[model samples]
Target: MKAFQLVSPGKTELRDVDVPEPGPGQVLLKVTGSGVCHSDLHLLHAQQLPFPMTLGHEPAGQIVALGPQVNGWATGQHAICYIVWGCGVCRRCATGAENACERFPRGLVPGPGLGYPGAMAEYMLAPARSLVPLGDLDPVDSAPLADAGLTPYHAIDRSRELLTPTSTAVVIGVGGLGHLAVQILRAITESTVIAVDLDQEKLTAARGHGADHAVLSGPEAVPEILELTHGRGADVVLDFVGVTPTLSVGAGVVSSYGHLTVLGLGGGSVDFSASGPPQGLPWGATVSRPYGGTRRDLHEVLSLAQRGLIKVQVERHPLAAADDVLARLERGEVRGRAVLVP
Candidate 1:
């Protein structure tokens, strides 16, 4: 199988590697679709892991083989890989919190394309436990729903209780996750959604997807968001871009008792002052960073896609064009999501 592997930091090699076979409780998926997440660049640059590592995490395809002890799964079944593999008996895994797998600390993150060899090649080996039925959804487009969709879904799930008809939700950095966040908020709740982005194109995309208001992120962003909410500010701020500028905008526009959930890896940080939050936040407001979604989150996110309630915009490329796709993503040329089809 030919794979696009990170032979070294900043260098990718398209080389042939042995296709893997499934072990007990595992399944082998024929590589169909894989998403190039922005975080993949961070993973490549961090070099925290070994060289020759595969870098895709969002994947979906059809099962071609199943190992022993794996029941109720058949070959040729269309499924989306869950992306998080956890110890079967652990409490976290028992409740579909595999993203927080206990075995993770032991260097086991059976999520193919990360700790495990990825679907960037012709074949992928993953745990049968990670397979979710894709049903009639296009496997290629559904790949981003696993991460880009699920990430915001998990963030919104936490603040769902706070969203009322009178509430306002602000989404900063309406790119991949940000654009999806807009749709998710509109689909599941009654809160008015506001999207902010430096790129006017993305802001336009956000509005087309269902954001009630879209603002060009800049010095005037805070005031515009405040105006949109009639000076009360946003009930929840989802910052998909974690740089200082966006974070500052997020802090400035979030209402009191609001929640600021930062999900970007832009290598930026915020310094909390003596006051609870940066600006308009009330005494009870909070800020947090949520990780990837749980298994249930994936299922729900996929269901949203299956029902046509949410859709991911993607630029498709052949597996051989992985390098070009990553470069375009880093340059922000790829809109919404980029999927590598093998």
Candidate 2:
């Protein structure tokens, strides 16, 4: 079998490895599609990593074999992999919020492509509990729902109370997650969806995904969002790019008492102050940094996709092109999500 492995810090290679068999409670999948995520690029250049780890987390495939003790899942069924492997005993997991499992390290996220062997290969091994049926959706295109779609769904679900018809929502960064965020908002909420992005192409894509307004992100973005909201600012701001500029715009345009969810790994921060508005977030505003979605979230995301309310705009590539695809993603040239077909 061929696998794309991170050999050392800031490097990756396509290497030959033996096919892994499913262990107890696990199922082996014949890889059909694996979505390439920005997180993979982050892991490539990470300061530290578990070398020789396979490098893909979002995978969709058909079940080929099930290990002992695994039941209810059958061979040849198409499924999407839920990447968050949480300790099921934790309080968070018990409540279906396993993305924030109590036993997970404070700063480190351990999952497929992070600490465990991933799906950027001919086959993948996943716990039966982590498998979500893909139904009739194309496995190659539906892979990104594992993360790009599910993450924003979780963030929006948490802030659903703020997205009433009279309210407004802003999405910053019209990349993979942001594009899906727009569609999710449109499908699930009546709040006016405003999208912001530096690239005109992405902004156009956002509008196509049902964003009511698209604003080119810059010094003018805050005012444009404010204008769109009639000077009240957005009731919810979802920042998919966590860089200083986008963070600044989100802080500038979120209404007082609104919710601001930052899902990007851009390594940026904002200052907090008692005197709000210009110096900090508005009074009563709340900010959250959410992780991946729980099992239920993944199921809901797939339901949306199955209903044709949302779809991932995917660009498929061969498994051997993993390096090139990561390069393109790093340079911000890949639109929508890139999937590796094995």
Query: How much lDDT does each candidate structure score?
Result: 0.86, 0.90
lDDT for model 1, please.
0.86
Task: Give the range where candidate 1 is weakest over 10 consecutive residues by summed lDDT.
Answer: 273-282
Stretches off by above 4 angstroms in model 1 are 103-110, 276-281
* TM-score of structure candidate 2: 0.98
TM-scores of all candidate predictions against the true structure: 0.95, 0.98
Q: Which ten residues in a row have the lowest lDDT in candidate 2?
A: 105-114
Best by lDDT: 2
Residue-wise C-alpha lDDT for candidate 1, range 233-287, written one tens digit per residue: 8889999989988888888877777898999988777657665433334667689
Q: Please count the clashing residue pairs in each candidate, in the order shown.
A: 1, 0
Query: Cα deviation in Å at residue 97, candidate 1?
Result: 0.8
Write the residue-wise lDDT of candidate 2 on 1-342 in tens digits.
Answer: 999999989878899999899999999999999999988878888777779899889989999999999999999999999888888778887876678888975955577787888889988899898899988999899999989999999999999998899999999998989999999999999989999999999988898899999999998998888888899999999999898888989889889999989998899887788884567888899999989988899999999999999999999999999889998999999999999999
- Best TM-score among the predictions, by candidate number: 2
Which pairs of residues collide in candidate 2?
Answer: none
